[model samples]
Target: MTKLILICCLITALVIRINGHRSSIFAAAPAPSAPAAGDIVADTCKRAAAGDPDLDYNFCKSLLQSAPGSHKADLRGLAVISINLAKNNAQRVLGHIRNLIGEETNNTYRKECLKTCKEVYADAVGELKDSAKSIDSGRIHDARTALSASFDAAGTCEDSFSDGNIPSPLAADDDYYQNIGRIALSLAALLDN
Candidate 1:
Protein backbone atom coordinates (compact mmCIF):
# COMPACT_ATOMS: atom_id res chain seq x y z
CA MET A 1 0.00 0.00 0.00
CA THR A 2 2.91 2.38 0.81
CA LYS A 3 4.44 1.65 -2.61
CA LEU A 4 1.08 2.32 -4.27
CA ILE A 5 0.80 5.74 -2.47
CA LEU A 6 4.42 6.62 -3.51
CA ILE A 7 3.62 5.85 -7.14
CA CYS A 8 0.45 7.99 -6.94
CA CYS A 9 2.45 10.85 -5.35
CA LEU A 10 5.05 10.65 -8.11
CA ILE A 11 2.38 10.76 -10.80
CA THR A 12 0.72 13.71 -9.08
CA ALA A 13 4.06 15.59 -8.88
CA LEU A 14 4.77 14.86 -12.54
CA VAL A 15 1.34 16.11 -13.55
CA ILE A 16 1.82 19.28 -11.49
CA ARG A 17 5.14 19.97 -13.16
CA ILE A 18 3.64 19.51 -16.58
CA ASN A 19 0.76 21.81 -15.71
CA GLY A 20 3.17 24.50 -14.48
CA HIS A 21 5.13 24.38 -17.67
CA ARG A 22 1.95 24.52 -19.77
CA SER A 23 0.74 27.58 -17.86
CA SER A 24 4.09 29.27 -18.43
CA ILE A 25 3.81 28.60 -22.11
CA PHE A 26 0.45 30.32 -22.13
CA ALA A 27 1.74 33.23 -20.01
CA ALA A 28 4.81 33.97 -22.10
CA ALA A 29 4.83 37.02 -24.40
CA PRO A 30 3.98 36.51 -28.02
CA ALA A 31 6.33 37.34 -30.88
CA PRO A 32 5.24 40.35 -32.88
CA SER A 33 3.78 39.51 -36.27
CA ALA A 34 4.43 41.66 -39.30
CA PRO A 35 1.58 43.15 -41.27
CA ALA A 36 0.51 41.20 -44.31
CA ALA A 37 3.00 41.75 -47.15
CA GLY A 38 0.48 42.96 -49.71
CA ASP A 39 -1.11 45.54 -47.44
CA ILE A 40 1.93 47.33 -46.04
CA VAL A 41 2.32 50.02 -48.67
CA ALA A 42 -1.32 50.96 -49.01
CA ASP A 43 -1.90 50.70 -45.29
CA THR A 44 1.11 52.87 -44.51
CA CYS A 45 0.13 55.43 -47.13
CA LYS A 46 -3.42 55.54 -45.82
CA ARG A 47 -2.27 56.23 -42.30
CA ALA A 48 0.28 58.77 -43.48
CA ALA A 49 -2.24 60.66 -45.56
CA ALA A 50 -4.66 60.66 -42.65
CA GLY A 51 -1.98 62.00 -40.31
CA ASP A 52 -0.74 64.80 -42.58
CA PRO A 53 -3.26 66.93 -44.44
CA ASP A 54 -0.57 68.07 -46.83
CA LEU A 55 -0.08 64.49 -47.99
CA ASP A 56 -2.46 63.07 -50.56
CA TYR A 57 -3.41 59.44 -50.03
CA ASN A 58 -3.60 58.50 -53.68
CA PHE A 59 -0.28 60.05 -54.53
CA CYS A 60 1.48 58.36 -51.63
CA LYS A 61 -0.07 54.97 -52.35
CA SER A 62 0.55 55.17 -56.08
CA LEU A 63 4.14 56.31 -55.73
CA LEU A 64 5.02 53.55 -53.27
CA GLN A 65 3.07 50.87 -55.07
CA SER A 66 4.72 51.68 -58.39
CA ALA A 67 8.29 51.69 -57.14
CA PRO A 68 10.40 48.61 -57.88
CA GLY A 69 10.25 46.04 -55.05
CA SER A 70 7.78 48.17 -53.08
CA HIS A 71 5.01 45.61 -53.50
CA LYS A 72 6.98 43.21 -51.29
CA ALA A 73 8.39 45.80 -48.88
CA ASP A 74 7.96 46.09 -45.16
CA LEU A 75 7.57 49.51 -43.49
CA ARG A 76 11.33 50.13 -43.52
CA GLY A 77 11.59 49.26 -47.17
CA LEU A 78 8.79 51.70 -47.96
CA ALA A 79 10.60 54.39 -45.98
CA VAL A 80 13.77 53.76 -47.96
CA ILE A 81 11.87 53.97 -51.22
CA SER A 82 10.28 57.27 -50.20
CA ILE A 83 13.67 58.68 -49.20
CA ASN A 84 15.24 57.55 -52.43
CA LEU A 85 12.44 59.16 -54.43
CA ALA A 86 12.95 62.41 -52.53
CA LYS A 87 16.71 62.31 -53.16
CA ASN A 88 16.29 61.64 -56.86
CA ASN A 89 13.74 64.43 -57.18
CA ALA A 90 15.91 66.85 -55.24
CA GLN A 91 18.95 66.06 -57.38
CA ARG A 92 16.95 66.55 -60.54
CA VAL A 93 15.66 69.88 -59.31
CA LEU A 94 19.19 70.91 -58.43
CA GLY A 95 20.35 70.12 -61.93
CA HIS A 96 17.39 71.97 -63.41
CA ILE A 97 18.24 74.97 -61.21
CA ARG A 98 21.83 74.93 -62.46
CA ASN A 99 20.63 74.82 -66.03
CA LEU A 100 18.28 77.74 -65.35
CA ILE A 101 21.09 79.73 -63.76
CA GLY A 102 23.16 79.15 -66.87
CA GLU A 103 20.32 80.05 -69.23
CA GLU A 104 19.28 83.28 -67.45
CA THR A 105 21.97 85.71 -68.61
CA ASN A 106 19.72 88.81 -68.51
CA ASN A 107 17.18 88.07 -65.72
CA THR A 108 19.33 88.76 -62.67
CA TYR A 109 16.40 88.44 -60.22
CA ARG A 110 15.43 84.94 -61.42
CA LYS A 111 19.06 83.93 -61.53
CA GLU A 112 19.59 85.13 -57.97
CA CYS A 113 16.52 83.19 -56.82
CA LEU A 114 17.79 80.15 -58.69
CA LYS A 115 21.15 80.48 -56.90
CA THR A 116 19.45 80.54 -53.49
CA CYS A 117 17.35 77.52 -54.49
CA LYS A 118 20.46 75.70 -55.64
CA GLU A 119 22.09 76.27 -52.26
CA VAL A 120 18.99 75.08 -50.41
CA TYR A 121 18.50 71.99 -52.59
CA ALA A 122 22.18 71.10 -52.29
CA ASP A 123 21.86 71.19 -48.50
CA ALA A 124 18.72 69.07 -48.79
CA VAL A 125 20.56 66.45 -50.79
CA GLY A 126 23.12 66.12 -48.02
CA GLU A 127 20.38 66.03 -45.36
CA LEU A 128 18.62 63.22 -47.20
CA LYS A 129 21.86 61.20 -47.35
CA ASP A 130 22.08 61.55 -43.57
CA SER A 131 18.41 60.56 -43.23
CA ALA A 132 18.94 57.44 -45.31
CA LYS A 133 21.88 56.48 -43.12
CA SER A 134 19.86 57.09 -39.98
CA ILE A 135 17.02 54.88 -41.18
CA ASP A 136 19.37 52.08 -42.19
CA SER A 137 21.03 52.26 -38.76
CA GLY A 138 17.62 51.88 -37.00
CA ARG A 139 17.70 55.44 -35.67
CA ILE A 140 14.14 56.52 -36.40
CA HIS A 141 14.30 59.90 -34.61
CA ASP A 142 17.41 60.98 -36.44
CA ALA A 143 15.89 59.81 -39.68
CA ARG A 144 12.77 61.88 -39.04
CA THR A 145 14.84 64.94 -38.22
CA ALA A 146 16.82 64.66 -41.41
CA LEU A 147 13.69 63.91 -43.43
CA SER A 148 11.93 66.93 -41.92
CA ALA A 149 14.96 69.09 -42.75
CA SER A 150 14.91 67.82 -46.31
CA PHE A 151 11.19 68.59 -46.58
CA ASP A 152 11.72 72.06 -45.18
CA ALA A 153 14.40 72.55 -47.79
CA ALA A 154 11.71 72.32 -50.44
CA GLY A 155 9.78 75.11 -48.76
CA THR A 156 12.98 77.13 -48.50
CA CYS A 157 13.47 76.77 -52.22
CA GLU A 158 9.91 77.88 -52.92
CA ASP A 159 10.31 80.78 -50.50
CA SER A 160 13.39 81.83 -52.40
CA PHE A 161 11.21 82.55 -55.42
CA SER A 162 8.38 84.00 -53.32
CA ASP A 163 10.59 86.36 -51.34
CA GLY A 164 12.07 87.72 -54.55
CA ASN A 165 8.62 88.06 -56.19
CA ILE A 166 9.78 85.65 -58.90
CA PRO A 167 7.66 82.68 -59.97
CA SER A 168 9.25 79.33 -59.10
CA PRO A 169 10.15 77.22 -62.08
CA LEU A 170 10.76 74.29 -59.76
CA ALA A 171 7.37 74.40 -58.08
CA ALA A 172 6.35 70.98 -59.34
CA ASP A 173 9.67 69.47 -58.36
CA ASP A 174 9.45 71.05 -54.91
CA ASP A 175 5.98 69.64 -54.43
CA TYR A 176 7.14 66.16 -55.36
CA TYR A 177 10.13 66.36 -53.00
CA GLN A 178 8.05 67.57 -50.05
CA ASN A 179 5.37 64.94 -50.56
CA ILE A 180 7.90 62.12 -50.73
CA GLY A 181 9.70 63.49 -47.69
CA ARG A 182 6.43 63.49 -45.79
CA ILE A 183 5.87 59.86 -46.75
CA ALA A 184 9.35 58.89 -45.62
CA LEU A 185 8.86 60.69 -42.32
CA SER A 186 5.56 58.93 -41.75
CA LEU A 187 7.07 55.51 -42.47
CA ALA A 188 9.92 56.21 -40.04
CA ALA A 189 7.28 57.00 -37.43
CA LEU A 190 5.72 53.59 -38.05
CA LEU A 191 9.04 51.87 -37.33
CA ASP A 192 8.99 53.27 -33.80
CA ASN A 193 5.51 51.99 -33.07
Candidate 2:
Protein backbone atom coordinates (compact mmCIF):
# COMPACT_ATOMS: atom_id res chain seq x y z
CA MET A 1 0.00 0.00 0.00
CA THR A 2 2.91 2.40 0.81
CA LYS A 3 4.51 1.66 -2.58
CA LEU A 4 1.20 2.35 -4.26
CA ILE A 5 0.90 5.75 -2.55
CA LEU A 6 4.53 6.64 -3.45
CA ILE A 7 3.80 5.85 -7.11
CA CYS A 8 0.69 8.00 -7.10
CA CYS A 9 2.54 10.91 -5.51
CA LEU A 10 5.33 10.63 -8.07
CA ILE A 11 2.76 10.61 -10.87
CA THR A 12 1.06 13.69 -9.38
CA ALA A 13 4.37 15.54 -9.11
CA LEU A 14 5.21 14.70 -12.72
CA VAL A 15 1.82 15.89 -13.91
CA ILE A 16 2.21 19.16 -11.98
CA ARG A 17 5.67 19.76 -13.49
CA ILE A 18 4.38 19.08 -16.98
CA ASN A 19 1.46 21.42 -16.50
CA GLY A 20 3.75 24.20 -15.21
CA HIS A 21 5.97 23.84 -18.24
CA ARG A 22 3.02 24.01 -20.56
CA SER A 23 1.71 27.12 -18.83
CA SER A 24 5.05 28.88 -19.13
CA ILE A 25 5.23 28.13 -22.81
CA PHE A 26 1.89 29.81 -23.33
CA ALA A 27 2.58 32.74 -20.99
CA ALA A 28 5.94 33.74 -22.33
CA ALA A 29 6.21 36.79 -24.62
CA PRO A 30 5.40 36.24 -28.22
CA ALA A 31 7.97 36.91 -30.95
CA PRO A 32 7.53 40.13 -32.90
CA SER A 33 5.54 39.49 -36.02
CA ALA A 34 6.25 41.31 -39.29
CA PRO A 35 3.30 43.06 -40.85
CA ALA A 36 1.86 41.70 -44.04
CA ALA A 37 3.48 43.14 -47.17
CA GLY A 38 0.42 45.14 -48.18
CA ASP A 39 0.13 46.58 -44.68
CA ILE A 40 3.79 47.17 -43.95
CA VAL A 41 4.08 50.69 -45.45
CA ALA A 42 0.96 52.02 -43.78
CA ASP A 43 1.80 50.38 -40.47
CA THR A 44 5.36 51.65 -40.38
CA CYS A 45 4.37 55.13 -41.59
CA LYS A 46 1.66 55.37 -38.96
CA ARG A 47 4.07 54.44 -36.20
CA ALA A 48 6.86 56.64 -37.44
CA ALA A 49 4.69 59.69 -37.93
CA ALA A 50 2.71 59.27 -34.73
CA GLY A 51 4.14 62.41 -33.16
CA ASP A 52 4.33 64.57 -36.29
CA PRO A 53 1.31 66.82 -36.62
CA ASP A 54 2.35 67.68 -40.14
CA LEU A 55 2.14 64.11 -41.33
CA ASP A 56 -1.34 63.15 -42.45
CA TYR A 57 -1.97 59.41 -42.24
CA ASN A 58 -4.25 59.26 -45.25
CA PHE A 59 -1.84 61.31 -47.37
CA CYS A 60 1.00 59.05 -46.37
CA LYS A 61 -1.10 55.99 -47.11
CA SER A 62 -1.99 57.31 -50.55
CA LEU A 63 1.61 58.24 -51.34
CA LEU A 64 2.95 54.87 -50.26
CA GLN A 65 0.23 53.05 -52.16
CA SER A 66 1.26 54.84 -55.34
CA ALA A 67 4.99 54.25 -54.86
CA PRO A 68 6.63 51.37 -56.68
CA GLY A 69 7.30 48.24 -54.57
CA SER A 70 5.41 49.81 -51.70
CA HIS A 71 2.49 47.39 -52.08
CA LYS A 72 4.66 44.42 -51.14
CA ALA A 73 7.66 45.95 -49.38
CA ASP A 74 8.88 45.39 -45.83
CA LEU A 75 10.05 48.18 -43.54
CA ARG A 76 13.61 48.25 -44.82
CA GLY A 77 12.32 48.37 -48.36
CA LEU A 78 9.99 51.20 -47.44
CA ALA A 79 12.92 53.15 -46.06
CA VAL A 80 14.78 52.82 -49.33
CA ILE A 81 11.73 53.86 -51.27
CA SER A 82 11.24 56.90 -49.07
CA ILE A 83 14.80 58.02 -49.64
CA ASN A 84 14.42 57.60 -53.37
CA LEU A 85 11.28 59.67 -53.29
CA ALA A 86 13.12 62.44 -51.48
CA LYS A 87 15.86 62.41 -54.08
CA ASN A 88 13.40 62.54 -56.93
CA ASN A 89 11.42 65.32 -55.29
CA ALA A 90 14.51 67.40 -54.73
CA GLN A 91 15.55 67.01 -58.34
CA ARG A 92 12.11 67.87 -59.56
CA VAL A 93 11.95 70.99 -57.41
CA LEU A 94 15.38 72.01 -58.52
CA GLY A 95 14.25 71.91 -62.15
CA HIS A 96 11.15 73.91 -61.34
CA ILE A 97 13.16 76.56 -59.54
CA ARG A 98 15.53 76.85 -62.49
CA ASN A 99 12.63 77.33 -64.83
CA LEU A 100 11.19 79.98 -62.53
CA ILE A 101 14.51 81.78 -62.50
CA GLY A 102 14.57 81.81 -66.31
CA GLU A 103 11.08 83.22 -66.56
CA GLU A 104 11.33 85.54 -63.54
CA THR A 105 10.10 89.12 -64.15
CA ASN A 106 11.65 92.44 -63.09
CA ASN A 107 10.12 92.19 -59.62
CA THR A 108 13.08 92.20 -57.23
CA TYR A 109 11.28 90.12 -54.62
CA ARG A 110 10.33 87.44 -57.11
CA LYS A 111 13.85 87.37 -58.56
CA GLU A 112 15.35 87.08 -55.10
CA CYS A 113 12.94 84.31 -54.17
CA LEU A 114 13.74 82.42 -57.33
CA LYS A 115 17.49 82.74 -56.77
CA THR A 116 17.19 81.57 -53.15
CA CYS A 117 14.94 78.73 -54.18
CA LYS A 118 17.39 77.66 -56.85
CA GLU A 119 20.32 77.57 -54.44
CA VAL A 120 18.41 75.80 -51.68
CA TYR A 121 16.91 73.25 -54.02
CA ALA A 122 20.32 72.53 -55.47
CA ASP A 123 21.72 72.02 -51.99
CA ALA A 124 18.73 69.85 -51.14
CA VAL A 125 19.33 67.56 -54.10
CA GLY A 126 22.93 67.00 -53.03
CA GLU A 127 21.96 66.48 -49.41
CA LEU A 128 19.34 63.95 -50.44
CA LYS A 129 21.98 62.05 -52.37
CA ASP A 130 24.19 62.01 -49.32
CA SER A 131 21.26 60.83 -47.24
CA ALA A 132 20.66 57.94 -49.62
CA LYS A 133 24.30 56.87 -49.52
CA SER A 134 24.47 57.17 -45.74
CA ILE A 135 21.33 55.08 -45.38
CA ASP A 136 22.69 52.46 -47.75
CA SER A 137 25.89 52.25 -45.67
CA GLY A 138 23.90 51.98 -42.42
CA ARG A 139 25.27 55.28 -41.15
CA ILE A 140 22.21 56.43 -39.31
CA HIS A 141 23.70 59.63 -37.90
CA ASP A 142 25.01 60.79 -41.26
CA ALA A 143 21.75 59.88 -42.91
CA ARG A 144 19.75 61.80 -40.34
CA THR A 145 22.03 64.77 -40.68
CA ALA A 146 21.60 64.85 -44.44
CA LEU A 147 17.88 64.33 -44.15
CA SER A 148 17.55 67.15 -41.64
CA ALA A 149 19.65 69.41 -43.86
CA SER A 150 17.42 68.63 -46.80
CA PHE A 151 14.36 69.49 -44.77
CA ASP A 152 15.95 72.74 -43.70
CA ALA A 153 16.83 73.61 -47.27
CA ALA A 154 13.21 73.31 -48.28
CA GLY A 155 12.11 75.40 -45.32
CA THR A 156 14.70 78.01 -46.14
CA CYS A 157 13.45 78.18 -49.69
CA GLU A 158 9.95 78.85 -48.46
CA ASP A 159 11.11 81.23 -45.75
CA SER A 160 12.95 83.46 -48.16
CA PHE A 161 9.63 84.72 -49.50
CA SER A 162 8.03 84.92 -46.07
CA ASP A 163 10.96 86.76 -44.57
CA GLY A 164 10.90 89.24 -47.45
CA ASN A 165 7.15 89.75 -47.00
CA ILE A 166 6.53 88.50 -50.52
CA PRO A 167 4.12 85.84 -51.60
CA SER A 168 5.89 82.70 -52.84
CA PRO A 169 4.90 81.53 -56.29
CA LEU A 170 6.47 78.16 -55.61
CA ALA A 171 4.48 77.58 -52.44
CA ALA A 172 2.99 74.33 -53.61
CA ASP A 173 6.33 73.02 -54.83
CA ASP A 174 7.96 73.99 -51.57
CA ASP A 175 5.28 72.21 -49.60
CA TYR A 176 5.71 69.08 -51.70
CA TYR A 177 9.47 69.05 -51.13
CA GLN A 178 9.00 69.66 -47.43
CA ASN A 179 6.56 66.78 -47.19
CA ILE A 180 8.97 64.52 -49.02
CA GLY A 181 11.71 65.48 -46.61
CA ARG A 182 9.46 64.68 -43.68
CA ILE A 183 8.65 61.28 -45.10
CA ALA A 184 12.33 60.55 -45.59
CA LEU A 185 13.13 61.63 -42.06
CA SER A 186 10.34 59.48 -40.67
CA LEU A 187 11.57 56.43 -42.54
CA ALA A 188 15.12 57.08 -41.39
CA ALA A 189 13.90 57.27 -37.81
CA LEU A 190 12.14 53.93 -38.24
CA LEU A 191 15.36 52.30 -39.47
CA ASP A 192 17.26 53.77 -36.51
CA ASN A 193 15.04 51.82 -34.18
Candidate 3:
Protein backbone atom coordinates (compact mmCIF):
# COMPACT_ATOMS: atom_id res chain seq x y z
CA MET A 1 0.00 0.00 0.00
CA THR A 2 2.82 2.45 0.85
CA LYS A 3 4.65 1.57 -2.42
CA LEU A 4 1.46 2.31 -4.40
CA ILE A 5 1.08 5.68 -2.68
CA LEU A 6 4.71 6.59 -3.34
CA ILE A 7 4.41 5.71 -7.05
CA CYS A 8 1.29 7.88 -7.45
CA CYS A 9 2.96 10.79 -5.67
CA LEU A 10 6.01 10.60 -7.92
CA ILE A 11 3.89 10.52 -11.07
CA THR A 12 1.84 13.50 -9.90
CA ALA A 13 4.97 15.51 -9.17
CA LEU A 14 6.41 14.66 -12.60
CA VAL A 15 3.20 15.69 -14.32
CA ILE A 16 3.07 19.01 -12.47
CA ARG A 17 6.66 19.78 -13.34
CA ILE A 18 6.06 19.00 -17.00
CA ASN A 19 2.95 21.17 -17.06
CA GLY A 20 4.76 24.06 -15.41
CA HIS A 21 7.61 23.88 -17.90
CA ARG A 22 5.15 23.81 -20.81
CA SER A 23 3.32 26.86 -19.50
CA SER A 24 6.57 28.81 -19.07
CA ILE A 25 7.65 27.98 -22.62
CA PHE A 26 4.31 29.11 -24.01
CA ALA A 27 4.44 32.30 -21.97
CA ALA A 28 7.83 33.21 -23.43
CA ALA A 29 6.63 32.79 -27.02
CA PRO A 30 5.67 35.96 -28.87
CA ALA A 31 2.15 36.44 -30.23
CA PRO A 32 1.57 35.59 -33.89
CA SER A 33 0.04 38.92 -34.91
CA ALA A 34 2.16 41.60 -36.59
CA PRO A 35 3.07 44.88 -34.90
CA ALA A 36 0.49 47.67 -35.19
CA ALA A 37 0.72 49.53 -38.51
CA GLY A 38 0.61 53.00 -36.96
CA ASP A 39 3.35 52.24 -34.47
CA ILE A 40 5.50 50.65 -37.16
CA VAL A 41 4.95 53.57 -39.52
CA ALA A 42 5.71 56.24 -36.94
CA ASP A 43 8.74 54.45 -35.56
CA THR A 44 10.11 53.77 -39.04
CA CYS A 45 9.58 57.35 -40.17
CA LYS A 46 11.18 58.81 -37.08
CA ARG A 47 14.11 56.42 -37.17
CA ALA A 48 14.70 56.86 -40.88
CA ALA A 49 14.61 60.65 -40.71
CA ALA A 50 17.01 60.49 -37.80
CA GLY A 51 19.21 58.04 -39.82
CA ASP A 52 18.70 54.78 -37.88
CA PRO A 53 18.94 51.99 -40.46
CA ASP A 54 17.73 49.26 -38.08
CA LEU A 55 14.46 50.84 -36.99
CA ASP A 56 14.02 52.56 -40.35
CA TYR A 57 13.82 49.37 -42.40
CA ASN A 58 11.82 47.59 -39.73
CA PHE A 59 8.97 50.12 -39.85
CA CYS A 60 9.32 51.21 -43.51
CA LYS A 61 7.54 48.14 -44.92
CA SER A 62 4.34 48.91 -43.06
CA LEU A 63 4.28 52.48 -44.41
CA LEU A 64 3.60 51.12 -47.90
CA GLN A 65 0.11 50.20 -46.78
CA SER A 66 -0.73 53.80 -45.96
CA ALA A 67 -4.06 55.02 -47.40
CA PRO A 68 -4.14 56.07 -51.02
CA GLY A 69 -3.72 59.82 -51.91
CA SER A 70 -1.16 60.32 -49.14
CA HIS A 71 1.55 61.16 -51.64
CA LYS A 72 3.31 63.68 -49.35
CA ALA A 73 3.70 61.15 -46.61
CA ASP A 74 4.76 58.54 -49.13
CA LEU A 75 7.48 60.81 -50.49
CA ARG A 76 8.81 61.53 -47.01
CA GLY A 77 8.73 57.82 -46.30
CA LEU A 78 10.63 57.10 -49.52
CA ALA A 79 13.34 59.61 -48.67
CA VAL A 80 13.95 58.19 -45.22
CA ILE A 81 13.85 54.62 -46.54
CA SER A 82 16.35 55.43 -49.27
CA ILE A 83 18.81 57.07 -46.92
CA ASN A 84 18.63 54.26 -44.37
CA LEU A 85 19.08 51.56 -47.02
CA ALA A 86 22.21 53.24 -48.26
CA LYS A 87 23.54 53.45 -44.73
CA ASN A 88 22.69 49.77 -44.16
CA ASN A 89 24.70 48.55 -47.16
CA ALA A 90 27.64 50.73 -46.23
CA GLN A 91 27.72 49.11 -42.77
CA ARG A 92 28.34 45.63 -44.26
CA VAL A 93 32.01 46.45 -44.74
CA LEU A 94 32.16 47.19 -41.03
CA GLY A 95 30.56 43.82 -40.28
CA HIS A 96 33.45 42.10 -42.00
CA ILE A 97 35.83 44.09 -39.84
CA ARG A 98 33.90 43.07 -36.73
CA ASN A 99 34.04 39.38 -37.70
CA LEU A 100 37.82 39.46 -38.13
CA ILE A 101 38.31 40.81 -34.60
CA GLY A 102 39.73 38.17 -32.20
CA GLU A 103 38.74 34.46 -32.11
CA GLU A 104 35.01 34.96 -31.59
CA THR A 105 33.43 32.36 -33.85
CA ASN A 106 29.80 32.84 -32.77
CA ASN A 107 29.23 35.94 -35.01
CA THR A 108 25.73 36.42 -33.60
CA TYR A 109 26.20 40.17 -33.11
CA ARG A 110 27.71 40.52 -36.55
CA LYS A 111 24.77 38.62 -37.98
CA GLU A 112 22.27 40.88 -36.23
CA CYS A 113 24.00 44.03 -37.52
CA LEU A 114 24.22 42.64 -41.03
CA LYS A 115 20.59 41.55 -40.96
CA THR A 116 19.56 45.10 -40.15
CA CYS A 117 22.00 46.47 -42.69
CA LYS A 118 20.57 44.30 -45.47
CA GLU A 119 16.96 45.20 -44.73
CA VAL A 120 17.62 48.95 -44.72
CA TYR A 121 19.90 48.70 -47.75
CA ALA A 122 17.30 46.78 -49.73
CA ASP A 123 14.55 49.25 -48.90
CA ALA A 124 16.63 52.34 -49.71
CA VAL A 125 18.00 50.84 -52.91
CA GLY A 126 14.55 49.85 -54.05
CA GLU A 127 13.05 53.26 -53.40
CA LEU A 128 15.94 55.14 -55.01
CA LYS A 129 16.21 52.83 -58.00
CA ASP A 130 15.03 55.52 -60.37
CA SER A 131 17.46 58.20 -59.19
CA ALA A 132 20.34 56.09 -57.97
CA LYS A 133 22.92 58.43 -59.50
CA SER A 134 21.75 61.30 -57.30
CA ILE A 135 22.56 59.47 -54.06
CA ASP A 136 25.78 60.55 -52.30
CA SER A 137 27.84 57.46 -51.57
CA GLY A 138 30.28 59.37 -49.35
CA ARG A 139 27.57 60.69 -47.08
CA ILE A 140 26.14 57.17 -46.84
CA HIS A 141 29.55 55.82 -45.84
CA ASP A 142 30.00 58.53 -43.23
CA ALA A 143 26.57 57.75 -41.80
CA ARG A 144 27.36 54.03 -41.61
CA THR A 145 30.71 54.60 -39.93
CA ALA A 146 29.13 56.96 -37.46
CA LEU A 147 26.48 54.39 -36.67
CA SER A 148 29.07 51.67 -36.16
CA ALA A 149 31.06 53.94 -33.86
CA SER A 150 27.91 54.87 -31.91
CA PHE A 151 27.23 51.21 -31.15
CA ASP A 152 30.77 50.89 -29.84
CA ALA A 153 30.27 54.02 -27.71
CA ALA A 154 26.99 52.72 -26.09
CA GLY A 155 26.03 54.53 -22.86
CA THR A 156 28.13 57.56 -23.70
CA CYS A 157 26.28 57.92 -26.97
CA GLU A 158 22.92 57.40 -25.31
CA ASP A 159 23.75 59.92 -22.63
CA SER A 160 24.88 62.44 -25.22
CA PHE A 161 21.69 62.06 -27.17
CA SER A 162 19.49 62.06 -24.06
CA ASP A 163 21.15 65.08 -22.50
CA GLY A 164 21.24 67.07 -25.76
CA ASN A 165 24.98 67.34 -25.48
CA ILE A 166 25.44 66.58 -29.15
CA PRO A 167 24.80 69.48 -31.64
CA SER A 168 21.17 70.41 -32.37
CA PRO A 169 20.88 69.53 -36.06
CA LEU A 170 23.07 66.53 -35.40
CA ALA A 171 20.90 65.52 -32.48
CA ALA A 172 17.85 65.88 -34.70
CA ASP A 173 19.45 63.26 -36.86
CA ASP A 174 18.94 60.70 -34.10
CA ASP A 175 18.80 57.64 -36.34
CA TYR A 176 22.26 58.34 -37.67
CA TYR A 177 23.75 59.02 -34.26
CA GLN A 178 21.84 56.19 -32.58
CA ASN A 179 23.07 53.61 -35.09
CA ILE A 180 26.65 54.73 -34.54
CA GLY A 181 25.98 54.58 -30.80
CA ARG A 182 24.62 51.06 -31.16
CA ILE A 183 27.69 49.98 -33.10
CA ALA A 184 29.80 51.26 -30.20
CA LEU A 185 27.57 49.38 -27.78
CA SER A 186 27.82 46.19 -29.89
CA LEU A 187 31.61 46.50 -29.95
CA ALA A 188 31.56 46.94 -26.19
CA ALA A 189 29.41 43.83 -25.83
CA LEU A 190 31.83 41.93 -28.03
CA LEU A 191 34.74 42.93 -25.80
CA ASP A 192 33.55 40.30 -23.30
CA ASN A 193 34.53 37.56 -25.72
Q: lDDT winner among the candidates?
A: 1
How do the residues 52-108 of candidate 2 rate in per-residue lDDT, one tens digit apiece?
A: 778777777777878988978776667777878878887888888888888877887
lDDT (10s digit) by residue, model 3, range 55-143: 44433444333433324333333343443443443354334324433333575554443344434434333433322222233233334
Regarding lDDT, does 2 or 3 come out ahead?
2
TM-score of 1: 0.78
Give me the overall lDDT of model 2: 0.79
Q: Which ten residues in a row have the lowest lDDT in candidate 2?
A: 21-30
Model 3 misses residue 88 by how many Å?
Answer: 27
Task: Provide the clashing-pair count of each candidate structure.
Answer: 0, 0, 22
- Give the best candidate by TM-score: 1
The better-scoring model by TM-score among 2 and 3 is 2
The estimated TM-scores of all candidates read 0.78, 0.77, 0.21
- lDDT by candidate, in order shown: 0.84, 0.79, 0.40
Off by over 4 Å in 3: 1-16, 19-33, 51-129, 132-193
Error of 2 at 152 (Å): 1.0
Q: Is candidate 1 or candidate 2 better by lDDT?
A: 1
Q: Report the lDDT tens digits of candidate 1 across residue range 44-68.
A: 8988877778888888988888889
Residue-level error in angstroms, candidate 2, position 134:
1.1
Better of 1 and 2 by TM-score: 1
